[model samples]
Target: MSVNTFNHRWASVILEALTRHGVRHICIAPGSRSTPLTLAAAANAKFICHTHFDERGLGHLALGLAKGSGERVAVIVTSGTAAANLYPAVIESGLTGERLIMLTADRPQEMIDCGANQAITQPGLFASHVTQSLNLPRPTPAIEARWLVSAVDNAVALQLQGTVHINCPFAEPLYGEWDNEEQAWSEALGDWWQESQPWLQQPQSRFSESQRDWNQWSQKRGVVVCGRLSAAEGQQVAQWAAILGWPLIADAQSQTGQPLAYADLWLGNPKAQAILQRSELVIQFGSHLTSKRLLQWQNACRPQEYWLIEDRPGRLDPAQHRGRRIATAVGEWLRQHPALPGKPWAQLLTELSSAAHTCIEQRLANEFGEAQVASRMSALLPPHGQLFLGNSLVVRLVDAFAQLPIGYPVFANRGASGIDGLISTAAGVERATCKPTLILLGDLSALYDLNSLALLRQSSAPVVILVVNNNGGQIFSLLPTPIAERERFYCMPQQVDFSHAAAMFGLHYRQPQDWASLYQQVTQAWQHGGVTLVELKVAETAGAEALRQLVQQVGAL
Candidate 1:
């Protein structure tokens, strides 16, 4: 019996289809059942394979690869508990519109739910989280090769929206290979086999909305808002705003994070809020914004025209406005609708922004602390480097105080916003793009993804992980909780030093004392040619307390 050939051929066809559609990276987790997929991927010259022992980290690794490479990346894992571990990254991919393909290996059909060690129900496993799902039977010659190709093509087409889950059940003898002549192919497939293209090419619609009222909308008092855009796109949006004489208020996740002079803090100022509220039209590009004040302003102000430009379909409007959600690429939308001549409608808004920035700079000028570090974050990174922002207090701190370096692409997992797997995701990004990476995370987040530090040693790019050790969750201080109960319940302080962790992982470690030395070391680490861990220790209550007073003073303005 040529069962091994059948299984191998099926796996080859599936992988070939994915590559034809421009997927080049495959993340693999070790398991016996997933042998067909692992072997097939390793044998293929087209795929850049990444292997991880932990499936959970592997899922996030694929997510980060998709984010960094801007292509559909696949993951291979065995069935049972391994398949369930992929749920976190799958859910994140769904929310953020990342393209991920999960190929899980399951036990054959007869291994029923009654009694099986590593077998579980495979159908509809990811539920609605993935855009498409496909379950394949064990190697069968009854189904022609063309049918398999078409099925894979059909399923992968939906990857543009989000994730695609393909479950393959392998009947064992999972080892030895066989001859190619056993499987039959059609004349059409013979032509397809020679070409490096998808068997079925589907046409895509150019755009969702027409360019009918672009001129009218462009002439109004418009404002540009950004949420999680690529660096190049954000810069173009910045240019578009400048050409139209509108102010650009970008979120923390935006590739080129022009912080709108710390919009999160300054928006509390009545004078600043009033000027922004006067905006007649608001055009928000992308989704998953980080600024609560800006989102609140959009909801409360209720501008005459609010247009959201995104490629994906669904309700991206958190403001719940009767706004037009234009389903199109930002570049295409900008191309179709050219802006009018540069006209300075409100120059005072720029002055207000500058004033707010000056007030923040003067306040945090004293010592080398978390707030100071975050405030000067834009200047902290070395030129031509990449960034990954962590969740919890650090991201909020950056959003509130720092303006990210212009033209440097920033990546984050804001969809789920959980602190877990952050280091793994960042390590994946570092591997995908061989550029110097600067990573910022709070103590708790660093601890949560501590296991992922092992992934860091493999990256060829220079990495600087700036762990702001606040000893606990500083975000709790912002909430209205009693001081007594908040200590252990809410804050959860873990006073473990990360230098020991860095040493255990064989990474270079440093503890920068002051801002001048901190900035010097961080920027220098980019040229250091290896992974360096830089820890900036501060009191647990420092960040939350400083921010409160800073905003209070800004509000008084």
Candidate 2:
């Protein structure tokens, strides 16, 4: 392949590398500068290209893909303000530590400052949020392929670690004849003449001396708090936990199964504070957690030794580690650590889990009316299906009423814990896995991503959205700072009917007003074909009191 030929095949090379590296989806937002990249991506059959008119939706869509597939996904857009539209998703992905790749098409140096329409300095634009940022060189047979391979490989490493940004800058004449494209790239390479950096094998990182102490400390009353784990990694961690007798406390985003299914002592739930107060060591992995109570508890206790593991160098502990980042596999650390001589932690945790299970069952069967709505819905969900829980009261209810289902991979946006992109992300998951995706969302979250209904038309998977409609953001009522005068600001309730919305999207809709109706509706939704929405209405005041009681029971454990 000659230098001229490189320009002709640059996108092909990049596409090939991405596909080979396991990029399953490419989300593209329409723009002029990005036409070449979009066209090339669309031409490739291996990659699934999803088009979104809105750049923000595109970013969220990519995020959803990554979340569903547990693989890195890329979002492509043109330069300038178009690229800026991705900031919200980028920030969310960064906070959640989601693996999203941002490919921005930019004007080269000359056109960048010449007052071009869509030109801007895209380099280092999202460097703060993303794991890596790169500016690609002029396409050349010799260098173009090399850069693509390098960019993707580095991007994957970062993506596996979290979110990343890569800027693809091209010279003038963004699009023209294929021959012209080749000729322009050839000339640019000739002008360069200098050699490019050769790629090298990434060095294998191992646990450091401090890491040895960290591992030892982690074994002493250490609780494994995982935000998200890939399917394979999740199983490995589970086995390691069994061997080490460690308690695995996971949030829905963890993509891993909690060790004890009905364990109320899991981290991030209301009970986690009581469990953590007795802990001497804490091993933090993945991104920031959601529960403000858990965050405050960790801050208050400031556990004796906190160890956080990350592939990339940075703050591992949300409590600001005070210790250095350990660049070793968590499994590796668990493998090296000596097994505990006694089973005090295991025995206590098992008792708590048993008691928690008993409490949940008693509450559901014998407790006050209205509490059964949440409990029944929680129980009706498939034990092994992917659960996309919405933020706010819905998530807390799942935490309160439901036991963590074994072998079920759960997910939520605990980083920011906002409800803006739930449906979009859920749509992405539906498209990616084609699995029966059950989204436990609140009315507000359902309303926020109503546009996601448009995207749902494109999904192949049958999604069952269980919208807990308490008329508004019921989570606000549970907060200590009640908005007496400012209730409207926090509890913005809308009287939007989901049945009408579902009809607009050509989806199945059902409004279950009672426990039996809700159960039957959920059974049909989960088993039926196409997308389905099952809405449940609960009283906010009664629901909050029940939740408070549930937390009290958790503390009792």
Candidate 3:
């Protein structure tokens, strides 16, 4: 297609450069100012564009895609609050080291600070969260087209570090006529337009530790703690843990199937704590463990030495416990060091964990509740499927109850750990993996991103959404708020059900009244390829009380 106006020409080059730079998917939110970019993305066959009415959801959708596919994903939105809406996702991407390209459209320089509609200070909006931020001038004959392309190339290259924000401001006639004049200007590119290669390609760099450091670090009686890791990375860490005879304390989001079962529960018990505290060193890979009890145990143990192996550049240890932080991939660290067979350091804890798991099983055997549902879902999820866990109570419940299923990948937005955008993020994961995905969210969380249900319609694989409806934010029930004021202040109960929501989103809805029905619904959803909402209705106070009772039982053991 020939572009006539400068806006059309600029949009074409930007979108074309993004595709050439290997951005396969683009999430777009509708607005007038961003029409040119949106239209250009739609016309480009190399880009798969997803439209969302809400920019907040759109940003998270791109985040999900980036995390799930392990590739850079772009998000386009209009000026003003639309760009501001992306701040949360940008913050998450920065913290998690995910590659995201944010293309925000804005008004021309003259329109800024003049009380113009849909115009705001678009530059540096994301603050320190973005890896790179650039404000591009409006397209003009004075500026070389190569400059624009090169800017895109550099911005995308910088995304290797984190999210890249490019604020593009367009002049009047945002959507102008496409004529031969613009086509002639574009033709000046000659062979560049037809080439599949990026205008600029930058090599990525890696960092590793000295073999002597590893040799010294590996000999200590250390425990292996795996936090949020990719499935492949988790497997490598698990293998290293087995070779070293170290106890692997895998977080729920670690996706390490071989982690010590009920490690969190065991840590809460005094007997198990005594065994774990004997360790002289702690080697942690990955970041953001979901268990507070486990974190407390780490602090209480106060090991003589703590080592953190993480490739990402950030402070993974908030407690300043890691004496040495090795900035390298876990696999690379494993490859550099020779395996040393040592005596089992966590055997007693492992034995105690087994008893804890058995106690949990007996407690939930006859009782069907939120924790039971999480346990059942953990066992029932397909080996090849992906599990997207919601934050707050749902993630805690899974961490405490769900057994790690082999070959099943687990994902969550643990960076910010907010309840917002759970559904949209899961949809993005489904889009990227093309695998059966199960999302376990709470009633309040589901409502926070309810509009994201529309995104599920585009899923290519089965997506079973298990909404544990206990009225409202039941997590508040566990807090120290007075019981009389808890409901009005903390657990704001939303008595509404999710069946109507499922119907509204064209998803198959099932209100499972018992464990059998819940399992049957999930199985059907997994077998059938579409979106399904399985709502588990339980008492609002029941989940909190159940957790309290379980903790008591495990502590007594």
Candidate 4:
């Protein structure tokens, strides 16, 4: 019953509350200030502790775990820049509505802003990005133990909406032995410690659209746009689209199998674009579409009515096109207002998409280019497996070329959409799912998150990291940047390869030169069940040229 030091006792109670509240994973970055929390986590048998040396990667690792497991994950870090390193992941969690619990160890009020070592103004650090931030007073016998438990409970509850930050301040003597009197303090907890339940339970409120609101646009000529949806939610959106006879423009991240395939291509084609503009209404289920062409279409069409259905409370409609914002889940809203069978309004668009898909197939066939590699990977993805797309050109390539296997869940750091944490995020996904996880990233993204390659060693599942090495940010070549300045400002060329990187990380490395070789390597890596880096080397300008050619062919069609 003697839990020893005040810091240990406080850490114990906080961790207990988190575990009882169903937080299964705790990511820790070692630091003197965070010794108490780290030791407490180590002591707790119910929690799975993951250690990361880099706080930034550690933060995104937690983000990926939360995303992959669909549960709240906690991250513990020391004060000063250690806490600051988690800012990017915190921002990502806020935008994606992922639950992350940040337990930052800090110095007490006296040390903060007083030139004390490893101390800074830690409170309100994440500010508005976090759903809730609480600065706990320094551990002391005077502070009520129940109050600490209650604070954790509240933070866990708030995390259902987004990330929660709990900053703990501790004075020196962070670690110490137990005393006889401390035994009584432990026993005082009584049934609170014995019961494997949270000290407090808070119910989450569900959002539902009013029937009147639903009825207003139920009969209009519309299209369902699915963006960044879960596989289950994507299925629901697809069902709604089918029943309502609306064309479903699904983003690669949507995980919807029945979407208008090659819709991006169709939207890019002037002739096909005209056909898609027939819709009088636009109903978007999620946000952050990977295609700029789709956004442009929405802006140009300026539909009479635009209704966005999403669970998160954010302005997803960046184009200001949403006439009505239904802050509710797509499935919940659909359930509230059952879809009545209607005439097919998007038959023309669907047919055009089919033609566009055929055109893309022809363009990618027999070509060992970036688009072909993406297409092959998408086709080879195992059923029910997970795909984590990096930012830059890779996600767009997959969005355009890949024919996703049915029910395969696609993940991306699209909220912030930065290339810093893709590898670490994918590692977290692999850790959580323990399934065949494939990562498609470009050379720039791979280099940006190069340090995260260390995380692959910890993954229990097979992770096939397909890095399309175009030598640099080849995406810039496709832009309107002048040719003379492209390499300096936009391309930022890197002449490095991943063969040595793979060896350094102890992964199976292969650089496939042809389509068949790449496909074979991917399949073997995925089937063999270990970490592998399949680098597909393409010319720096090949990707941009392929895209241009594809658009031209689609336009011709």
Candidate 5:
């Protein structure tokens, strides 16, 4: 077979292995260097291929798809800065364990270290950000094809823990006639060539059950807190907490029916903290809790037994507390341990949390602002939709105040939480779930990902890009920075609007002046079935200031 044929065959084998490994989605950024992987993906009927102009946006798109579908998603990008642009998403995958298979095309070894253009070091580009890295040399008859398939299978094996970078360095003459004649030369393919399975099967990741007497732990007053999880995991864990009669503090990402949903705010109350702090055992169901106050309390109180249960194996504790870190699926763990109920603990926190939610309702009554829009999430959204929260003030608003609509899936770039590619990620979530999507973001975040609005235009389901036009990074105002450097350096206010951006993208645009009008606009947009940009122009400090006041009042409870 010709060299070009070998390259295509090599790329095809990798794609096929990824397919057998349960990757149904592949996000590709348009580039010449990545043509082999892109064409291989296009030729296959097993994958739904998505193409984007930006590698950064493409990585986030794959991330959202993987997080929504609970499967590994593939990404194909060219070498040089295109691969470098994926660093943010790579870091996020590392932190959150959303599996990404990045197939980056690079120049052959001959082109490197010789002042070659577009040949900056491709190996170890992602470094520690990815879980595994495979730098494949140019396809040659000297190297058996079976090694390529096995390499892919081993790297992608039953693992959903972060990205696996596969760098393909191809020589010139990349595009040419493809032939399977090379397959005949390999006696090594074994039965793999004829079968539709992976070259190898990987070991299942099992939880090392320190299975210490659960009977002893179950008797103690326990608190179950959940972070980012699949919709089903959230519902099941919520049921477990309910049956056990333990107080459940879940992040908005879980979208579980929370009892003390406003605990992020009400946890500020000394009375509430004192009641929860008396717990003999504090059992957290997941990692990456959004509530700083709750995490701080745990760090200070340091309960006799503070056990954390997460599917990902890592030291995920933000406080770095010495606790039992169990690695297992939430479902598997729930099934193994039956709920042994005792008198409910921290019941008083419910009343204080209710007060905080009530405070939010009263303040946002018949008004439209950043806080108002965020506080209305439970009502503004229906269960048939999903949420993609931006990294700035809006996410914190939802985390602190909003009680989610149960069973509605929520997506966010909480890992390496940067205000970039959010629009593309939300669009990917819409495509994956085939449900209405609501993207709540600050004006600055919208500005950062402004180009990604083009992605929304291609959505198959309804999408609402709710831009809280606070005109700057209002999240900065929450900090106690000196007044001299606050506005110009931190807030970096931008006097711009999204109406033209919506118009540019051929999307429906609405700037609501009141709360009722905003509600109608968003709900109606979903009903109309397309992308809509709803801009809420508010004061620079409204969201942060309101949140501070809400916490203060809730503390008085």
Candidate 6:
């Protein structure tokens, strides 16, 4: 009688299918069932594997990678609670329309009834939060190979809408050696092309709307406010803005080119009072927007018509009806809106924009603190690298003064704005693509997810994190909470040195006390290195004043 031996052939097939689909990086949390997948991924020279102790951070890392690369990235973890750890990033991805693929490894269906260790009803765990969910069985080489390809294709497709999940169930014999790696890869690749029907072509539709002529609805005082968008998307929006003779008001994540008739798109929050009041029409696209003033304008001015162009409309603020949702792509809407003759609106908006930018530039020039650190770092970021701006003070300061050097891809979590797993997501971005990834975060955001730095050990792209350590949660001061109570609960300031944390995780770390030194160090770390941290200590009160001053200047404009 011949004895049947178990092998990791199934995992190799699954990993190969993902690699074939252009998934270059995978963030993994250690577990028995996930071992085969991780090992196979690690062995594949084309694929990078990032290891994280926390599954939550792993999920965010994958999201960050997806945002940076503009390609869907996956997260691998054990079943049961391990799969649940991906919830935070899943929610963020769903709300912001981020393309993140989550791969949770689980025990076979039979094991679920027996109460197996780390086993639960994994199906539908993230169904509500994700665009779609799928599960595949670990079968023999021939069957599993086909399933692997199908799973990868489905994951990529679902990512177009938002987040997607693929749960893999391994029966037994968890680990072994694969005798034929080529056979596994060929089978999966072949099956995917042959059997899996591609849904690549989403037929473009002509935009139909009531107001074909934007001039009919509003005159020379028009404003273009862009949210988070890809480079291609930004260009499309910019072209549209040019045709309409509207001045652009862009967020750092908006991707809209600078000097859009307006000297700076991000003049400290697009929703600021001054900008919104000056504009008669406000057309918004993508997401990553956190402007209280915009919401206030929507309620107060109640413009004749506030048009929202989105692939999926009626999602942005349910309470307000000041804007009617136009179910069409921004590019399509812009193409249909008749071109404007003069640059009157553009000129007025530009003057205001230039004044605001001048004030911000002056403040940044005078200060060598955390507030200036963000703007300074923004000035230094590579023109084409991916930037993952962490939430809290970092994002606000970036919003105030940081202008994305032209041609860079910028991303952030503005849907729910939580500092839980930013670094993890950014690390995921670094691991998944060959491009340079920069994470500009405050000390609070860094401390919130310290486990993310540990995931850097397996990344292929160079990741440079600028940690603006203001000692505590400086953003808390701007809020309405009581100082002492807020300091303890909301701020929760901890004096954790990122240097020691990085060393503990076997990563690189640096402390730059001045602007020149920080700039030189950051430039070196970002240009050539694995994963490095540049920590800067600044005064919280002064940083807050700088941010407030930026806001005031934008309001004055």
Report the error of model 3 at residue 416, Å: 0.5
TM match of model 2 to true structure? 0.81
TM-score of each: 0.96, 0.81, 0.96, 0.95, 0.96, 0.81
Model 2 has an lDDT value of 0.66
Query: Per-residue lDDT for 396-423 in model 1, tens only?
Result: 8888888876668889999989888898
- Tens-place lDDT per residue, model 3, 1-557, is 32227787888899999888779999999998888788889989988888899999999999899878988899989999999999889988888888899999999899999999989999999989999988899877667788888888887876655789999887767665666665666666679898988777886777675657666667777888888888888887787788888888888877777468676676788887877777877888898888878888766668887888888876688788847888788778878776688777768777777787788889888878898876666656854788999999988888887777644688899988999898999999889999899899999999999999999998898888989899989888777889898888888897898989999989999888888878877888888779899888897777777777788888887
Per-candidate Cα lDDT values, in order, are: 0.84, 0.66, 0.84, 0.83, 0.83, 0.69
State the lDDT at 149 in candidate 5.
86
Give candidate 6's total backbone clashes: 6
Off by over 4 Å in 3: 1-4, 182-190
Off by over 4 Å in 1: 177-188, 256-259
Model 6, span 1-557: residue lDDT tens:
00012235566656666665567767788888777677777877777666677888878877877766766676788778999989999999888766777878888788887966888888888868888877776555445445555666565654555777888787666655445444534454554434324423233354566574656654556666677777777877776677667766677777775543123232333444455566766677765564444344444655555666666544574436476677666666666665565454546456666666677678678778877766655666754578888888777766656656544677777777998998877776665556677788888888888876777776676778878888888888777878769878877778777788888888788887777887787688767768888788777567877766667666555
- Superposed Cα deviation of residue 350, candidate 6 (Å): 3.6
Query: For residues 113-217, what per-residue lDDT tens digits would candidate 4 score against the true structure?
Result: 778888889899998999998889988767677777888888787665678999988777766774565545545778988898778888778666475856657
Off by over 4 Å in 4: 1-4, 213-216
- Stretches of model 6 off by over 4 angstroms after superposition: 1-25, 35-53, 113-115, 135-159, 176-221, 257-280, 298-301, 312-314, 322-338, 346-349, 361-365, 457-462, 505-508, 526-531, 549-557
Q: Candidate 2: which stretches are off by over 4 Å?
A: 1-17, 107-121, 136-160, 169-177, 180-226, 231-280, 284-287, 310-312, 321-325, 338-341, 345-353, 362-378, 553-557
Better of 2 and 5 by TM-score: 5
Steric collisions counted per model? 0, 2, 1, 0, 0, 6
Q: What's the lDDT for candidate 1?
A: 0.84
